[model samples]
Target: MYRIELDRDVCISSGKCVAESPETFRFDSDEIVELVPGAPRLPDEEIFDLARDCPSGAIRVFEGDEEIDVH
Candidate 1:
């Protein structure tokens, strides 16, 4: 299983994440990325790809206690 997190302060508002995974992520009024409520879980590889694709490195993926290094 995997977990995901986003750092709003670190987001660049590039919209890459939202564009790639509209079902899982969206932009708020301020344009910062926010997770969609009750969104379906993505596959493990997709989760890692999404995190790695964040230009601002704002997306974080984890497996239990250890954070996956997507950089």
Candidate 2:
């Protein structure tokens, strides 16, 4: 299984992730990207694409302890 995480400190509030996968991500009170609780999950490839599309490179996908390089 793959795990996705948002680096809030690195996030630029681009909303690209939310726009691409609103079911998996959302904006917090401060407009930083956050994972939605109990939201529907996206496939690993879709998640990777989302990360690749992130301008700030804030989205990170990991398999176990290894971080996948989206670029």
Candidate 3:
């Protein structure tokens, strides 16, 4: 399975990730982006898209330790 991570220190909270995939991403009380704990499994393409859409480059996807990217 894949893992999702959000670095709030770098996130700008543009809401693009939430708008693209609310099922797996959301905004915290502080307006920073966060992963939805226990979220349903998402396709690799969608996950990559979410990471690509994050303006601040805060979202990271991994299969173990290897980071994922759109290209």
Candidate 4:
């Protein structure tokens, strides 16, 4: 299982995360990024790609409490 965290302050609104995993992410009314509540689980590879594709490096992927793919 995995958990996703997004840093709205660091987000650039690039839409890369949403484009890669539409069911997992969406834009809020403020135009910032937010993880979809109760978003469907995604494969590990897809999780890595979501973080990798984030130009602002605002997306935080976690396995339990350990963050992944946030470089």
lDDT of 1: 0.93
In angstroms, give how far residue 12 of model 3 lies from its true place: 0.2
Best by TM-score: 1
Taking all chains together, each candidate's TM-score versus the true structure is 0.95, 0.94, 0.86, 0.85
Per-residue error (Å), model 1, residue 22? 0.1
lDDT of 1 by residue, 1-71 (tens): 89999989999999999999999999999989999999999998889999999999999998898988977
CA lDDT of every candidate: 0.93, 0.91, 0.84, 0.83
Q: Residues 1-71, candidate 4, lDDT per residue (tens digit)?
A: 77678889999998888887889889999888888888888887777778878899888888888887556
lDDT string for model 3 (1-71, tens) is 77778888999989998988888788889988888888898888888887887788898888899887744
Which candidate model has the greater TM-score, 2 or 4?
2
Each candidate's clash count? 0, 0, 0, 0
State which candidate, 1 or 4, has the greater TM-score: 1
Q: Which segments of candidate 2 are over 4 A away from where they belong? A: none
RMSD of each: 0.8, 0.8, 1.4, 1.5
Model 4: which residue pairs collide? none
